[model samples]
Target: MLTARFKLDPEDRVVSFHLEGHAGDAVKGENIICAAASAIAQTAIGSLQDIARIEPDYQAEDGLICCRVSYDGDDQDQLIQIASLMGSVRIGCMQLEDSYGSHYITCIDES
Candidate 1:
């Protein structure tokens, strides 16, 4: 199984996901990114079933896609839930500072 590493910052709405072991290109990378993002968004949106809009713009570097997630919500718990759900998609290193309004989450694919 292929492994990937991702660093996420929910407050900044940015993530850097690194793919390894044969994962390649923007097309394939998009799937993984979207999957993780969708899981997070799904959790955050909850029963509301609101879809978070993902911007098309992304940066690809050495099989990594630096993507951004944009969503506006009032609850921090919801964001944490989203980050946690992403952990299911990939092993994540998450950092959050409510005082500073900063959330950083990193995920590495473990298959």
Candidate 2:
């Protein structure tokens, strides 16, 4: 099963996410769950760096991805954007977890 993990800051803000196993779940277009998970994760990472202008420590390889970003507490814009983006990550992950019922995917690390 695919595993989704979110690392959170002390205030419960998402600092990073780690996903594994989905990309290899099936042949192309065979697993909708894998595609949806990939989309949600990639969008979150791209939007954080490209749209929010927050550079994160990240790594990507076949069937694996991890990204972490530190937010500036003094920057209101960063806080707002990060909050929303991270919330999206949380929601997307939880929705998948709920809908798939841990057979296709599982959420971890208090996410």
Candidate 3:
């Protein structure tokens, strides 16, 4: 299964997200679950960098994606944008998990 972890701050804002493992729903190239997850994750990262103009720390490799956002505290606007984008990512991940329980799992951690 593909596991997605969202790390949040005390105020419930997402600080980072990590995705690992493969969705063995189908053979290698035919895994729709993996494709869906990748699309959502890549879009989230792209939006943060392209639209929000926040270059979050991130890494991606075979069956793995990890992204971290460090807020400036002073930039409320940027913070809001990042939160909104990350929220979308969380929602997408939850929906994917719901539809493909056997292939996907999502978890959220608040600190």
- Give me candidate 2's TM-score against the actual structure: 0.85
TM-score of every candidate relative to the true structure: 0.31, 0.85, 0.90
Better of 1 and 3 by lDDT: 3
Best by TM-score: 3
For model 1, give the 10-residue run with minimal summed lDDT.
95-104
lDDT of each: 0.37, 0.79, 0.82
Q: For candidate 1, lDDT tens digit of each residue in 18-94? A: 43332222465464533454443334334223332333234444433333333356766655544444443333222
lDDT, residue 71, model 3: 73
The digit string of per-residue lDDT tens for model 3 on 21-44 reads 788878865788778878888999
- Which parts of model 3 are misplaced by more than 4 Å? 108-110
Find the number of clashing residue pairs for candidate 2.
Answer: 0
Relative to the unseen true structure, what is the C-alpha lDDT of residue 83 in candidate 2, on a scale of 0 to 100? Answer: 75
Please give the lDDT score for candidate 2: 0.79
If both were scored by TM-score, which would come out higher, candidate 2 or candidate 3? 3
Model 1 whole-model lDDT (C-alpha atoms): 0.37
